[model samples]
Every structure is written in C-alpha cells, then in structure tokens.
Target: SDYSQEPPRHPALLVNSKEPFNAEPHRSALVTSYVTPVEFFYKRNHGPVPIVDDIDKFSVSITGLIENPKELCMKDILRLPKYAVTATLQCAGNRRTAMSKTRKVKGVGWDIAAIGNAIWGGAKLADVLELIGIPKFSYISPCGGKHVEFVSIDKCKEENGGPYKASIPLSQATNPEADILLAYEMNGETLNRDHGYPLRVIVPGVIGARSVKWLDSINIIAKECQGLFTQKDYKMFPPSVNWDNIDWSTRRPQMDFPIQSAICSLDDVNNLKPGKITIKGYAVSGGGRGIERVEVSIDGGKTWVEASKYQKAGVPYISDDESCDKWAWVLFEAEADVPESTEIVAKAVDIAGNVQPENVEVIWNLRGILNTSWHRVHVQIGR
Candidate 1:
C-alpha cells in the first residue's frame, strides 16, 4: 500500500506495471553478457518493497515444528560460513506476452527478458539449519518437519495483503549440493532494495517464486506453505481448463522451469540489410541441467544449423564440465546468410535431452506460464 518505499530502477527497463513494480531489460541487453548486471536484471515483485534500514535489528525467525527455534541476526549469520554462487532466475510468466497472443491469459504481460543471471553471496541454508540441530539431507524428523517455508516482509493482495511466502521440500533445503542460500548480496554488491535487501532465499534450479525476497522468517512445516501464489497461482493447467471449470487441486505448484531459449539479437519483427547476419540468444534448463546444444533456423523450421554456446567469454560451454555453472544460462550465437525475407527460430536441448516445444498453442495455459516454445523472429531483408 505504501509506494514511497520503492527504490529507483534503471530507466532502460521496460516497465510492465507500475504498482507492485515488475519490469525487465530489453531482449538485446540480456545476451550482452553471461552474468546479468543488477541494474539490467529483471524485477518481479508482488507488492510494495519493504524497507529495512537497521541491519543490526534485522533477524529471521526459524520456527514451526522444530525443537530448537532460533532467531538469527546479521551477526549470527555472518559468523558462520559464506559462499557465492552464480545462478539464473526465470519467472514462470517470462514470455506471457507472446503466449497471450494465442488466447487471453491472466497475470502480468512480460516480454522474453523476464530472466537474468547473477552471482549471489550468502550463507548456505543447510549450514544454517545445522545450527538448529537439523542434519544435512534430513527430511521428516520426529518433530514432523517436511517442508521449509520462507515468508517475506512485503505484503501483497494475492495473499490478502499478507506477506509473500512460499516453501520448498525439507529434503532440498537440507541438501548442501542443492546450493540454496539465505542470500544477502547480488552481483558482488550488497543487494539493492529492488532486490531482497538485507536477506532473501535463493533456491537455485527452481522457479523464481520459491526465492522469497525481503528476508522475514523461516518456518519448518509439515506441509507446503498454503500461500495463494503456491496453491492457486503458478500451477500449470491444460488449455482445456478454463476459469469456470478450473480446479487448482488437480495440479501441484510448479517448481523447476522447463527448457527455454529466445533469439534476443532481433525483435519480434525487424528490417535488416541483406547480408551475413549474426544471431545471438540465451538457453537454460531447470534442475541444474546444462545446455547441450542450441540450433538456429533461418528458413523457418525447415533447415537448421548448430549454434555455438558459451557461458563465459571465449570459453566454449561444455555441459559436463565440473566447473561449469550448471544453474546459469549459456549464450548461443551463429552466423547465417540471408538474401530474402525469412523467419528466424532458435531452440535448445539440455544435458537431460529436454527440448523446447515447437509451438506455443499446445503448451498454452490459463496463466500463460512456462511458454518455452521455440522462439521465432520475422526479419525483412532490405537491399
């Protein structure tokens, strides 16, 4: 309800909505680098950003179904271990604008830029849980803790103006390899207000909703958080399911995102001089899967050419590399000769062999989430 607390954002960002601020960078800016700058990173907020001016007084309460409930302050967290991770976060509605063209869908309209990669610095949740006597990989204990719910400080209408909240399986929360973090920094700098300031949860390889911002409290619960975003929204529904016949219970909350890619070098429609053209984009998959291959087609989908993929500059991306940032995205590029007007399309295959669907119509849902359909751009060749 308070608009004065929101922080200033970059002027280049394409503002999708004013209230509950949601905006993203231009598609071309996304592929300029592997690690997205904080200023260019997509912003997705449910409500007005909460302000936490006093770092000393900020604390996150660990409660619910636990024998040793503890309140961790900034000093307590900093005393433990610190780790930095490079990960990408993509909203479920990243390509909602394109999806809505097929049929009207609910939620904010977003272009293809609602995704970004950044290096997050913070304490591991597993290590933090250990301080409370919860061992690694522990799921349901005698106290009945099966899910780890994260509650944010910001209030949103979705939860009846309650704090935005979500949860993850306790198993994932306790797994050190999962790389979940109670993050306090982004892109090597203290997190800005636009992002979760002071602290926030970072659940790598999952949908962005689970990464609650504006650190509030953590709850070890027996079931998933019954927040509106978790229970009613973000769940994938078939095209057949409409508002009148919708059954939220039929589907579970979406976690990992599907394989996705988009041609960022060009807009949805462009006019260019006929000659050698360079195409660039980004590709990523969920659950820590690496991108195996990225293909580009200039003549629609009839013929395709393998595009080069890389995560770091001058370093070719190898999906199985031990040092590779599995949770981040790879930029793909290729060169093609164009003498006539044609449609350009890009698709990717992950290490697990997951490929983007060819069309958006089949995957269309009421919420227009996870539109990982093949990305296409129509280019007019000019003399």
Candidate 2:
C-alpha cells in the first residue's frame, strides 16, 4: 500500500508545508500521550520519498579526506554489532508557527508537531567511522576546513535549485554523547517510507533536518557542507529582524533545541462536570539534558504546583540507561477541584531551569523558531 497517499489518522493541530514534505502537530499534542505512536508521529521530509527496491544492492559510500574509502552493503551494515536507543527527533523549526506569528519567514509553517520520540535501532556511527578509517584526532571541519557533510540517496530538481543535501558540524558528528546512528528501524519495525526507509542518520538531541533521510554518503571534510539546506536555511534570527533588513551571512544555523514543555489536554473548549479537572502534557530539552521538573498552573500562572511526575494516563515508564539517556519526554499531570466557571492554564519547565516563556509575544521571532510559552485552554462547566 502507498502510505504517502493515505490521510493522517489522528487530528493534526498544525500544517507547516505541503506536497513531498510536511510538518504538523501543536505543543498541546505532546502531552496527549506518553508514547507517540508511529501513526500519529509528526512527519518531516525534504524531498520526495526515495524508493529502494533491493536491500541487497543498497550500499552507503564513505569517502573524502579519509585514508581509506569503503562501500558497505546492507548486509554488511546489519552484520556489525547492533544497538538500540530511545530518542526524540525534533525539527529545528518545530515551533516555527509561533515565530511566523511575529513576522514572515521562509520554509514550512511547522507547528509543535515537528518533534516526536521513538526507539531507534541501528549500528553505532562511531563504529562505522572507525571501520572507514576516520582517525580519532581529526577535528571536524566547519565553513572552512570545519564541518562534515551527509548526503542523502534521494534527489529532486527544484525550479531553480540543484540538489538537496544537509550537513552538521564535526563536533556534533563525533560527540560520543550525541548518540548518532545509521538507523534502519524505528519502534521495533522497519522504517516507514515517509520516515526514510532502508537507512537514515539519527542524530539525537540535534535538529531533524541534519539527520539526513535516505542517507547515501558521508564526507569527512574541513569545511561545512555548502548545501542550501544547511548554510542558507534553518538559522534563527531576532524578533526585531525582518526579511528586508536581515543579514543572511551573520546568522547561524539552529543546531541544538531549547528546553520546552506544553499542555496536551483541555482543548479550546471542553465540557467539564465541575467537580475535578486533570491537566496533562510532556516536557523535553535538547543537548542531552533531561527534564528536571514540570510545573502546572490552573489559574494562568497566578499560582503553580508541581505536576505529579510520570503520572500521566498513557506514558510508559522507561528505565535510565547509557544508550537511552532520559531522552523521552516526561509525562506530567495535575488534578484540582474546579468551580462552576473558570479557564485552565498549564505550562512546563525543563532540567536547565528554563521555563516555557510566559507569553508567545515575548519569544515570538519573525520566523517563529522557538514558541515555548504557556498553553491555555477554556472549558465550560456543566450544571
């Protein structure tokens, strides 16, 4: 069956772009469930999904600035020791919608759904790099002798653009804590075509775009991959800056995500019996930082209470491990006696002591990059 043609099953709260690639979901959805099912997980793609007919013939080429070049087939990659990790994949522009509210920005109008968490299974990237003879001492190259580039097997001809490619700094590529992988499976099954079938790079704690899908090649270089996806886009700018008065050269690409949390319950309108109401949601942080605490407020931040940890309805308990570094979001809940008429407000805080901004207007950027703010909902109390 062609999955691409099928409509999304769950309700989508946001839609960033259309056609070959799309991004969706709002911050409110994050707390709806602890384990975001693959069917409901947000989908983010750069180009048309590439079809790989034969797994046997599929091979990833490793070249550039290395003492040895090697081509490893699917069989060869699977033969190497396998590893599993539970991690989250978030788009650099996951909150772009919030940013767009301030000013116009290029690219998709992604909402909070650009991020999701799952168990990723694959070969360790460090092991793969060692097999290809990438010396341990080689410092990752960036713009000039500084970055490592990852190329995808998929290709497309845009109106005036050449091909699409994504890159990352050498530090992110080589960091042991980054948990980079040549992932072949997600949530215990073969990767779906939309999520990059056969093989894709999974860089935990980094932006999803850099985790190039349909991964085909890796070039260890002294300069950043000069692809449009990396250098020309995904950069963050101040709210004061607009398209007409911006300096593209001075901007930096978004790498690590910031601490964020959101309320997943109490939609714009809900009918409550007027006895008790429960608030639920999830909170996460980038750069391998775990969520320390999540606080909920029912009265618009006027007063706060620590949400009961891991007490949400649908979240599964995950044990801590070296490979699974507390990466999954923390599901939280708060139950309170409610009056006949009132509005419900909720927010979250991460391990770094970074609370979700009080108002979207405060952190609203022209591009809607980081929209971490208090989530509010109104409910009518029933007689």
Candidate 3:
C-alpha cells in the first residue's frame, strides 16, 4: 500500500488510522453550520485513495444481466439531468468508541463524528440506468437481475486485495424518488481524492459503506453483492454472539441508521461557570425519516425537555415537508441554566416515533455498529 499517494487532509481532523485513512472532525465542528463543509467531512476509506488523473478517459462500465451493456464516460454521464441532494452519510461504526466501553467490539474506534452532511451534485442514477436500457422504477431485469452492484477502483485487505464493492436492491436503484446519485461533485466543488473524484455512487439515507467511492463499474446481479464488506462486515450481532457462534448470513447488512442525537457544545467531561448555557448539536434519522423531536436531559435520564429543531437557520424543521431536505439532518438547540454540576443527555425521535435506546449494553453487538444510545456528557459547574 502506497500511502504517499493519498491526498492531503485537514489539519484539525482527529485521525484514527493512517493507512487506509480514517479520520473525523471534533464533535464541536459538526454543529457549527447546517451544511458540513467538505474539509470537515469524515473520511472512511478501506484502501489507498485511487487517483484518476484523466477524467476524459475514465468511464464506468455498466454490465451484467442487461440487454444493453454500455461503458459511459464522464461526458456521457454529464449529459444526463443533474440534481443536487443534501444528504447525511454516516458510517455503520459511527459511535464505536461508546459501544466499546460497554464491552469490547471490533472495528475503528470512532467518536460521534463519524458522520457528515453534504450537498452532492451529480447525475441521477435512475437516468443513468435508463441509458443502459433499464427503464425507471424497474425492480428486476428480464435476465433475473435483482441487485445493482457498485464496484470501486480502490482495493482493501478485507476483500483480499480485491476492489471494494457493495450493492443496493434494483428497486431502490431505479427509483428516481430515492434520490440516488452517481455523484461527481461534493459541496459544490469537484470531489477531492479523499472522496470519490471522477465518480461515485451516493446511496442516500443508507449506511455510508454502501456508497462506494471511485466507482469503476456497475453490475446487475441476480443477488446482493457477496463482498467482504457486505456479507462478512457491517452486519449487527447480538451481545451474546461471539466469533465462535457468529453466523454472517444470519443477519442482513444494516441499511438505514437508527434515530441519533448528540451534545456537541460540551465534552464528555467539562468545567464551566454556573450560568445560562446554550446546548446545541445534530439530530438525524435514516430512510428518509425526519427528526420529530430532540429531548435534552440535564438531570441524567430521569427528566427531559424537548429541544427546538431546525434545518435551515430561522426555519423550523418539519419532517417530509417540501421545504425540508428529507435526507439531511436537523440541528437542535436548547438553553438551560446550570447552577450545579449535573449530567446532560440528549436523545432523538424520528417522525415514525422511533426513539434512541436508553442503554448501550442492551443493543451491544460484536461489530459495534449502530450504537444509537442516548449521548451523555457530564458537566462540573462553578468552583
């Protein structure tokens, strides 16, 4: 692995791993603005970032179980109708660090920052599929293709040095309402090497792992992708299940993230002058669900207060509304008077009434994915 070829990263990022680089911004950085800047976006990579210097020559091969297999180059894709989508991409292991404290778990040790919201610009994947002879909203092809596999140019040890790949159901891939993008730009600029540069698949509202970057090809398969990251990794397991008894096929890959919220204005432990305090952070749900309410608790979890939520500044957030970006996150804030030392906690509820669990132990898994437990931070007020 040639680490030298990797692109430069933001100096403020807290790097978790150097090779196959993975880093995240501080929790405070996440809530500074509604749309996360590209520089502050978390980087989750499985291998060295592949360099594609020749955009004109680069192309994505669309093949497998298709009537008309076509290799669409940059120009060919750019001709399709363009759409901009503001979506949040969260790693399946976003809160692995918190999960690890309950019990030992595998994978990267990440805090609450393994997530980011960005405005992605690109051609609609449904439009691209239409060019390859698949009509919009088709669930299966005439040749028995049920899944759309996205293969990347980057290689990882997890796949035994094979190119990383993942897949989505054919129904989702062909549904224009899904807002799936073969994204070419991030945050209004051409994607930097850290992100998918020439091309990538943006499977909005799903776990970030399925959005394969630096895309090399698209495959119409009879079944879901059998890649290591798909079949062996990213699946949740019971707390009682260990490597000995773990069955990979028993559980399906995690898709939509659960309801989640966190306190970014304060640290895990903080000392502050006793006075009025403004608590702010991000709240988001998966599968196009909107955050209904964010509750803040200053006296541990015994009592709670509903925090105000919004997506754009000065505009109240309403789920599934035309104005609200259904795939994006909502930022919440609440003011409190802290006269004595107390533990502060925050939990989110989506529009569907799904609330984050109260305890991490109960939802503990071997892989440490989807730890949507209440986020807690302790405060020591005054001397």
Candidate 3 lDDT over residue span 144-255, tens digit each: 3599999999989898889999998898899999999999999899988998898989988899999999999999988889999889999988899998999999888787
**Candidate 2 lDDT tens digits, 98-130:** 566555656577655677878888987777877
Report how far residue 128 has shifted in candidate 3, in Å. Answer: 0.6
Clashes in predicted model 3: 0
Give the runs in model 3 whose Cα sits over 4 Å from its true position: 140-145
Tell me each candidate's TM-score.
Answer: 0.98, 0.86, 0.98
Best by lDDT: 1
lDDT leaderboard ranking: 1, 3, 2
Please, what are the lDDT tens digits per residue for candidate 1 over residues 1-383?
88886898899999999998999999999999999999999999999989999999999999998898999999998887899999999999999999999999999999999999999999999999999888998856633348999999999998888999999989899999999999989999999998899899999989999999997899988888888988999999998999999989888899999999999999999999999999999999999999989999999989999999998899999999987898999999999999999999999999889999999999999999999999999999888
Order of candidate numbers by TM-score, starting with the best: 1, 3, 2
Instruction: Tell me which of candidates 1 and 2 scores higher on TM-score.
Output: 1
Give Cα distance to truth, residue 346, candidate 3, Å: 0.5
List candidate 1 segments past 4 Å from native: 140-145
RMSD of 1: 1.7
lDDT of prediction 2: 0.70
The 10 consecutive residues of candidate 1 with the worst lDDT sum are 137-146
